[model samples]
Target: MAQNDTFNALLLQEGDPRPIAEVSTLNPADLPAGEVLVAVEHSGLNYKDAMILNGLGRLVREYPHVPGIDLAGTVTESSDARYRPGDHVLLTGWHVGERYWGGFAEYARVHGDWLTPMPDTLDARGAMIVGTAGFTAMLAIEALEHGEITPGTGEILVTGASGGVGNLAIALLAALGYRVVAATGRPENARHLEALGARSIVPRGELAERPDRPLLSERWAGVIDSVGGDTLAHALAETQARGVVAACGLAGGAGLTTTVIPFLLRGIRLQGIDSVQYPATDRERVWQRIGDLLPTEVLERCLAKEVGLSQLPQRAEALLAGQIRGRVLVTPTDH
Candidate 1:
């Protein structure tokens, strides 16, 4: 493609009360400077993406920004020796959408270091199906294992189980032979959660409120909690002795109001998962593991919907409202 060739992208511009998101046309020259230029095939619609699209968080410092944190595509040009034309790759984190120009466009120019070559088992679309959420889920599981929480230990609880990270966590945990209890506010999604390998469902209300006591009944052997705040506190309170809790998202809230009783008495370990700046040297192995754990069928089962750039503004609103479930894929070329 020529530098002058125009492509479509969802551009975010400053608005009075919120950011204005619309599909705009741009040339390759308009992309931010980087060592590699990729022809983006798929991007994932994540919580962070929604926040950026809606201008909730001050993620983007400048206007006319592209806000897609996760992308999978084929390299079209490269100055970096590690990547070359026609190389399939995937990217997540490194504050791509927040601090830098990101992948909402049909093409993206990014530092070669931010990209990971796609695993042989995963295609561009499948890699995006796993995306940042699935990557974080894998990291959480690894953290739990490091804390000695095995499948045979006991049941595992997945908070925010209807969301992307929680859905993938439940599927991955169950695939690894652990019994999973999914926690969600939407009771209507119980059957859907079960289909994604949740052995049981826990009403969000049961854990949404602050725990009356510092300690609750011992239940989960380990937990992959995507909803922080009261739900995290509740999970900590009910964790079994020596259990591990991987705290990831803050969809519920960021504050944690809990006592140290679970830590001191039950020996619980609260591990924080950050996929954004995860070490690049270790990404390839992790991606391979994700590819192995999440097969095509599992990914398809978890996918909620697929939309184009033109549809993202509305979808972003629905996602933040908690109306969206599972994963939502974005096809930049569709519009």
Candidate 2:
């Protein structure tokens, strides 16, 4: 009976143009079996979420899917003793939006193991603002630090510097005292990225194109690379000896056309960053650090737009077109 209760959701249906999303009421029973049921307060749009929404990546294997990769909300019920009603939680990665029913709805039933108890300083809205993008950025930052890349090592290069991950990385690195060089295709967003704490801006074209040689003059001591493909190759070629490059996304392209010169000669460390399946203890640690490093005001600035379930389709299209910037928060209840 309780499972029959209906709530509004952004349902994605298989269709001609691709996965088509529209607002619809869903039953709690329709949700995949999991240990916790969340009364989702907010979800954030990520590039991967956009791909699922637009059916670009076939990320959702089934029809009538709910596509939201990141959500912050309050737990309404829990089968696992670790959580309970009234507990605030955040969920990102773990192939949620892709392989499981996700947070594009007012309610989400998810594995208790996939949930992170929200930090004391972070509310549901604040957590969603940082979402998966900021969380990944934090992971990258940790990897860089773990690799012995300190703030004083040299300037840090953040490719795809205007996207959610890029902007968040810039803010986090800047807050930690690193000199960040934000590389972006949109020179127009230079001022915006600077406000997020980038020390300087480099045109993305400088990195997107494949370089002739396998290596270039060392220009960066560390890098948070979200663009991937040729951009990743270029970042590798230009990193200082022993530098760490945290590869997170494939927004530009997935192919990395580079030689072993950087790895062998320079001892460059190319660390692949994956927020999905990140250990729970580490997730909590990273989230707590995010709350400490990124102030409320800084997180607010990262928010580019807030929309309801009804508005997600348009925003998803814009995101896939590379027309939107920063993070887009989706409020299902607002719909």
Candidate 3:
């Protein structure tokens, strides 16, 4: 049987540290049972991917696995008629990198249902740059739009504003003409966030130290909250009457210790943003808007680091410590 070059991807064994992806020659035997096999070009590093890499989280139930949740590439073979060879594609979520093989490898074999044909204009690298983090940010923005963010509405607050989703939210909201107040624990990144279009910077200490109150001074009309727990609660207490908050990640903590005053008395609306299992059509629509709204400059501001697959393990630790900002894209071929 003819062999092809096998690509490298980050993998974690059941009980190992300092795990690194290895590149090995591949035969048809290595592919999972799927209708489509795509030659992946770029993959994204997400917080969850870090969790999997460090073996600190339950995301990866098994070992000897690829750990990227987002990938963009071209189709090499497909049994699904909707797809054919040479078509570019992007995959986000779908229990990939957890229950099944993921995009960290040089190739990804996934089911047709889990794949989205890449928008005609976006190539593989560009798409991965907008990977799961940007996708989640766009979804949060979409939820906020439906909640009615207008210029008349006061400033919008973005918690965890230095992270991938938070930064993207700041840029997208600002692009939509809403004043954005970015909150970050790192004072050093104030100007960085500001350049990404945050109208103001609120130190994480200031917001995270908010006193427990039934309601706070109504400071924001809209909020893109990635830091859950007390930060999310404080944001709720301070949301303008009839304002909306989109709660996505739990970077602070999962539990929301909040009173119903914001919802019952002020009529505040809280929308949960989940990108992992979002419907395909909905995902495509968001991708289309991402292609249009996330222009090169905006994307550039978000691209914090680019590391080869060999460098993923250490980078994963940095991400888990919240030491890295913006977004990190992984190129398997950079070795």
Taking all chains together, each candidate's TM-score versus the true structure is 0.99, 0.97, 0.95
Q: Report the alpha-carbon TM-score of model 3 versus the true structure.
A: 0.95
Worst 10 residues of 2 by lDDT: 55-64
* lDDT (10s digit) by residue, model 1, range 140-212: 9999999999989999999999999998998899888899999999999999899889999999999899999
Better of 1 and 3 by TM-score: 1
* TM-score, model 2 to reference: 0.97
10 residues in a row with least lDDT, candidate 1: 55-64
Give the candidate order by descending lDDT: 1, 2, 3
Give per-residue lDDT, candidate 2, residue 75.
Answer: 93
Residue lDDT tens for model 3, 1-335: 12565555555556655444554444556767899988889998998888878776577776677778998888898899989999889999888988998877787788999998887657777788788888888888887778877866789999998899888888778787889999999989999999989988998887785457889899998888988988888899989999999999988888877777889999999999889899986777788888877677778788889988778888888987899998998897785
lDDT of 2: 0.91
Q: Clash number for every model?
A: 0, 0, 0
Top-TM-score structure, candidate number: 1
Off by over 4 Å in 1: none
lDDT of each: 0.93, 0.91, 0.83
Q: Per-residue alpha-carbon lDDT of model 2 for 1-335, expressed as tens digits?
A: 28768999999888987876789988877888999999999999999988887778667888778889999999999989999899999999899989998888999999999999999889999899899999999999999999999988999999988889998999999999999999999899999999999989999888888889988999999999998999999899999999999999999888888899999999999999989889877788889999999889999989999999999888988987777889999899999
Could you tell me which residue pairs clash in candidate 1?
none
